[model samples]
Target: MAGAEWESLEQCLEKNLPLADLREVKRILYGKETRELHLPSGAFEAASKGDFELRGYGFEAAEEQQRRPRIVRVGLVQNRTPLPTDTPVVKQVTALHRRIEAITEVAATCGVNIICFQEAWTMPFAFCTRERLPWTEFAESAEDGPTIRFCQELARKHDMVVVSPILERDAEHGDVLWNTAVVISNSGAVLGKTRKNHIPRVGDFNESTYYMEGNLGHPVFQTQFGRIAVNICYGRHHPLNWLMYSINGAEIIFNPSATVGALSESLWPIEARNAAIANHCFTCAINRVGEERFPNEFTSGDGKKAHRDFGYFYGSSYVAAPDGSRTPGLSRNRDGLLVTELDLNLCRQMTGRYKMYARELTEAVKPNYSPNIMKE
Candidate 1:
């Protein structure tokens, strides 16, 4: 009757009650007849007389028939900007506009209902140069900016869900900048945006110089296609971020990122796959391609010192299933869209196989063993 009493039923099932006793509990809970009974003689007599209180039994067969199935198709687009090293920022944005249209056109042709762009896909990752420029002024308000308008139009034109990340200039807050991703619906409506929660300041990755930390908290937007979540760049490194999205009912998550060579590039696919397995959700990791360079820094070295010079963005974009298996990714050295079709049914199938929704006693002990000091 009570929620706590229902929980006791689960505990009793784990203890395996005698058949006669289990049947009596079922009869009391659901007014059903037991198909067969298996019990010791003593327990059988008590159950026959309704003297022994029964536990751990339910009419699961009836509930199974009422459940419905869900299915959806998702896609990811990964590409490189063809901007030469000396191109002006305005021209770079113009070039990106054409590229977005091209990628969206490809996605439409492939019959993808939802599409995503790599992180900061609007402009070349210029923070690596460590130089201030008037062009960085290209950053605009994510909601009404040129980038958002462009994506909104594409989503509407293709009748698809679009996830686009850009350098956002917070118009309301002294025009402070943030690394933000916006989700647009098939109708060209701006759903919401998630700013990069974790900013990296290591080596040549100077994100702090251009953008401040994001203020919009983690959000899972419900769409006609499905419930989806957005995790941008460095946010993927934090496990709790994925957990937040999962608990909020996200069936699909897009990790749009922009990072330099091997080490960080390698972590890109790793994080997305881990999130899918741990949360029983489909994940897509989209990355930028090609080399972007600036003055006072002849950084596009192809050999060993590649990571330091304007970091060559290795474009190995990929998609991971709920079972943690990854699809074929694009070449790390080339620029192209890595397309794949993911069945949302696989998420449900994986959950059933892994029992991710099934409660376990071990979970209660996890807090004691947790390595995060911030949790305490």
Candidate 2:
């Protein structure tokens, strides 16, 4: 589809929801349980004129005598590389920083408490090319990398927690690389980080050539907004990855990813939504948009001819609440920001209703499984 058509469709869907009861329209198009929030007029105007798409949704839970409602607004950003993948590392990084910075400024106007970027937001999704030198150049120290420093400033300025997924270079440990996400607190302090537990070798996702499995296990960071965790990229395909984050007391889990349409588009919506329902926690699935072409041709090892680019990175970023209800996703082909307000109390409400004793079940089933295979 053309760019203009996609923008028109996005605006129509976003505007029509607030104008009328579109339950039937939503049921026919977006899922039946989807809900949207009416945002300020300035947000829509910003999206109409800016370089990115904007959307908002709100989820609520029942009131209680013991505790008040804990509403936290979250922002998920999906964007394409502003420059070509073959551009110089510094130039490419600078272009991405500018793109994300502008979108984030708009998110701050929407009063987002926490915001997350698509996986490898500072660089192109070039791992599929499997060429080492230039791609490896993108990896940097998570503690004080240029990307983290940029995000820290925005977090501090907006008083919003930021989840930044990047290719981490463990400078202290032989400069080993890991797929990691750094969590910046609202105060701009580095709360902690989580590394992707699973790596993919499927299709053109030649990720193992770049980095091995991560050393850091699932660790949740307690930010000023809420307790959250990052399940970076391929880790979303693993059920245990999601379960462990919930076990670590993560109220919200962000899955920052760089996936293409041909490989996992069908599984994209299902996994995160299912995880939220089963784990009793919120899940934000963020993916970059647009196609990224490389200088050299590469093969997927699937008997297909070599190509210069992987398939399109479908955006479709969205948030799923613990009650199995989700907000509509961002555009599949445009740079977009999805803003949603969630009640953390919904996790507790769902927990009481589901009554799935995951801890007990795991304890009872652990002995029967092989000890070596069960080791984390």
Candidate 3:
């Protein structure tokens, strides 16, 4: 048959063409004979077929075959900063810009495509009380915020997707405040924001004091790098939140947090790793480091008298893979950046191997046969 007159694979398969026609179609599509025929007389027949004639078939097959996985480098910046109220707002903004620039430069050198910083990257965790002025001063609109502008410049310069969490000043609605994480694409475009869904109000970490509950739902942003999601500090404790992000098609999720001391610190890795395993997604938890003090009396269990002293902020920034394996994070002792190469293809491989997302197949068990229970 002439190459132009050949039938498509779907047509050939559906029509159940004769062995000879099938061989001809296969040769036309694959550039070689791909079918064998066994005659009813117990005789096998083989025929030499020419090279494939359909360029479109070759293109389709090449596209269907999985491409080699590229290494996606990610960096986590674990740094310490005192409350934004403690320093001049301009000075604080400049300092944050400098720190972000330094980290972006380092990430560029390391070939990191996605860089995530600790929560409240532009300020300190000053929501330890009901007073709204101090925290409100730190909030800025995500579009025109100094921090967002700084991050956009860095992202454009380094060609990296920057995940930055900040106290967003929403000017559209009576200047309402929210704990928001802005995702900036590689080309300096704002993808979307994930608001801190679960606001915590326990002890010294009174997030409700300053910011209201996140109005935005759990959302995953699609970028050139990958499908990414963010869950702020307190939101990390909820499994449903992580699952929601995963269901929304997040391949890698970021958890930027700001909690001090051992109790909250201990729960960090556990929540991140469990989320990764359960949702079949990679999780990066970036926590702040150093000691943050609140000028108020606070007491933990054991009757230890304390005032104006919140325990140390343990900086344990870690990256957990879909297989539940994690890379050790930056030390709690000082400020540093943790950089690692993540193979996102491995997420699909692990999911396939463990059937993590194959609920339809795994849950398709046959019902038990019970003759005694059958109705007469």
Candidate 4:
């Protein structure tokens, strides 16, 4: 079948596919809902016994029983691939290093305590080709990769926590590959790692071609500022993935992604925000900006070119707080940073002390049936 013909068929099938709840969409367009998420009393002190004020970001609450609000200034970079379309893998990595240096400098001046990079920040979104040459060669040992060392240098220099997402090559485990995130603490120590749990097999996102499902369970690292976790890329779509991080006591979760405008742009904003409010944790979504044109035309085994350009990776990176208030997103066409403040106490506010209205689309939409993904 022709590619366009297949698209038409898929669209026809999708019209009745039932993922779209028109009432919910209508409610989303017409309604104004509060986004406050609940945090049980004394959750901050309970999350950690270490002195949070020693870092110079918090203070004691007026009441002796109450802990002071923990504020973390986090910076998220929405960057474009810094190298040209035809650069060598080595040069591409070098260019990315320089780009992050510049961005992190700005973040430091703004007093950001923690910062996150976009998904696979060192490489282009070239997995659509499914060709193994230089792309596969871009993978590196997550723990000892040059990129990890590079971010560690900056982390130590700025005293900032750096979350770097990349393609990882694990030699100890049969040299298997995975999409991974490395957490570098403020003192340049490698805190730990989390592999992306979900790999997208739909359309051109065939990330499973390069790696299998992540084996490491959800982990939230204890940092100087707070407990944090990384839900790399496609994991953002799975509500359970976000819930696991929250369940593990993560106050903030950074979702580093590389998604184009043509695919799930509308859902991009809703999913992350809903997760933050639902899971009662701060959520940050960071997408790479700009279009990446691969060196050669590629085909999806379909007699025609699947895509010469992978389309624009619209970068609208933003941070959503537990209370549902969020900073405005960054630019779609430019490299940008969102340096925003987070009061971790909102995640631990006294239950029922504040009656913030959250959007209840359940009443507006039809009674839902479980999909197989949800059923199993």
Clashes of each: 2, 0, 2, 2
lDDT of 2 by residue, 49-166 (tens): 8767888888878889998899899999999898988789999999888888888888999999999998878888888888887999999989999999998999999999999999
TM-score of 1: 0.71
| Ranked candidates (TM-score, high to low) | 2, 4, 3, 1
In model 2, the runs with Cα more than 4 Å from the true position are 1-35, 349-376
Q: Report the error of model 4 at residue 68, Å.
A: 0.6
RMSD (CA, Å), each prediction: 19.7, 4.8, 20.9, 12.5
Number of the top TM-score candidate? 2
lDDT of 3 by residue, 94-170 (tens): 78777667656755765678988888888767676445555468788888688888889988998999998988888
Against the true structure, candidate 4 reaches a TM-score of 0.76
The segments of candidate 3 whose C-alpha lies over 4 angstroms from its true place after superposition are 1-65, 82-85, 294-306, 349-376
- In model 1, how large is the Cα lDDT of residue 39? 23
Q: Is candidate 2 or candidate 3 better by lDDT?
A: 2
- TM-scores for all predictions: 0.71, 0.88, 0.72, 0.76
Q: In candidate 1, what are the lDDT values of residues 178-275, reduced to their tens digit? A: 88889999999999888888888776677887887677777999999889999888888987687678778888889988876644754665788788
Estimate every model's Cα lDDT from 0 to 1: 0.68, 0.85, 0.69, 0.76
Candidate 4 C-alpha lDDT tens digits along 262-314:
67677877888888887888899998877788888766544665567776777
Model 4 gets an lDDT of 0.76
